[model samples]
Target: MGWIAVLVMVSVAIALIAFRVLRRKGRDDGDHGASSVDFSANLALAVYLLVLAYAAVLCRDGLSVSEADVQAEAESLTEMYWSVAPIPEAMPVRSQIRQYTAQSIDLDWPLMAGREMSPIPGQTLADMRATVLGLRPVGEESKNLQQDTLDRISEVSHARIVRSDDASTGLESTFVILMIISGLLVIALPWTLGVRPTRSSIIADLVRVGVVVIGVCFIILISHPFSGLGAVEPDAFKAAQRQYDQIDGRFPAQP
Candidate 1:
């Protein structure tokens, strides 16, 4: 599931808990000192807010790093495709590389971004290897083309492997858990300190709810750094595909 949904759910759960706590306190006949309760509640809210802010910052940084890594891998693949395109005999292999690279960006990328593993791993790898093998005959005629193709193939292979590994790391789970914990803490802070039922207290509750709602919206808005969840961003994937296309275009012109 997306982080937005998780955030909303957590917010709702916290709100419900807060409501129950308020109901219980309203019914209590004991003379609890309002001043002491207010002081404690405010203090707890401050601490919770501080911790939530820190966690959000940390998660944001982690997501940014992950995105950068994915982009780098895409660029690397593009460069690899272009590097060996100057060889005439490797044209067919170059075409295959282009096709695979396009598939990676157009198809595999969305799946990876959504935290799904590739369904046809064996076939994908086989296709990549086939492209590498196709360059073998041409490599015999030109040592430079052969060496270049070999190097490009290695780069593409390594990038693909790293991408696959990154997709499986389950970063989304960490995000979901953090959001849930933050929501719970937000709600529990007010309850544990026994917030009064004054007009000011009601305003504070409204403000807290508003904060949670805003946080949920922010998470949803930023979920799409390039392309949201399922949709493909052609421009985002362009760097990788361009390299593949350049190889395809150049192979025929060489030798």
Candidate 2:
């Protein structure tokens, strides 16, 4: 943040100094093809703004999808945990569910920020599925419950994969580099019109640069799913853990 502030100040100082030097030398006589300069500046500004807008949309969509995936996984785990109660051999399965949720909240959440997935949760979930399949359902209702439990497990798997994928999702590096270059160019365009270094002109230039800095910075901050000020939280996983606590405490006899 300090460096960013310094950079902004330095860029503004340079632009102001250049404007003053050009004006003193009578180089900004407004006679060097004003129309052509206006056309090029306008075109650059248009393209820069369009790219920024597109990047903003992508960030928004990624955030929304990631949030939804978290909720979906949590809900599916809750359902699967509940669905196991009807089977006689489901106590171990219930324990597995609890372990998976605990590991996800305690281990997976932090690892996800670095795009690293903890294998324990996946392995526990797979074991839970195998254990569920091994349960011998003697009645139709028990069979149906088993099927539902399997379906919920499937949902949990899908949601978990999606959450992992989104953990590292963001604007591509190429696009980010392009955005930075274009943002700088956008701020530089005003000076190209040979505008005089009057107080009003300098203030306008400063304001334009400040606005671009804020916008570009904002987009970059939110682009990553697990980093920066706008990064997504593990609220859904936390809620799942809380639910597990409630359920696990209720069944003190089961371990």
Best by TM-score: 2
**For each candidate, C-alpha RMSD in Å?**
4.6, 3.6
Alpha-carbon deviation at 38 in model 1, angstroms: 3.8
Candidate-wise lDDT, in order: 0.58, 0.77
Instruction: Residues 142-161, candidate 1: write the lDDT tens digits.
Output: 66656665676666567667
Task: Write down the RMSD of candidate 2 (Cα, Å).
Answer: 3.6
Model 2 stretches with alpha carbons more than 4 Å out: 1-31, 134-140, 193-196, 245-255
lDDT of model 1 at position 145: 55
Q: By summed lDDT, which 10 consecutive residues of candidate 2 come out lowest? A: 246-255
Q: Candidate 1 has what TM-score?
A: 0.70
By how many angstroms RMSD does model 1 differ from the true structure?
Answer: 4.6
Positional deviation of residue 63's Cα in model 1 after best superposition, in angstroms: 2.7
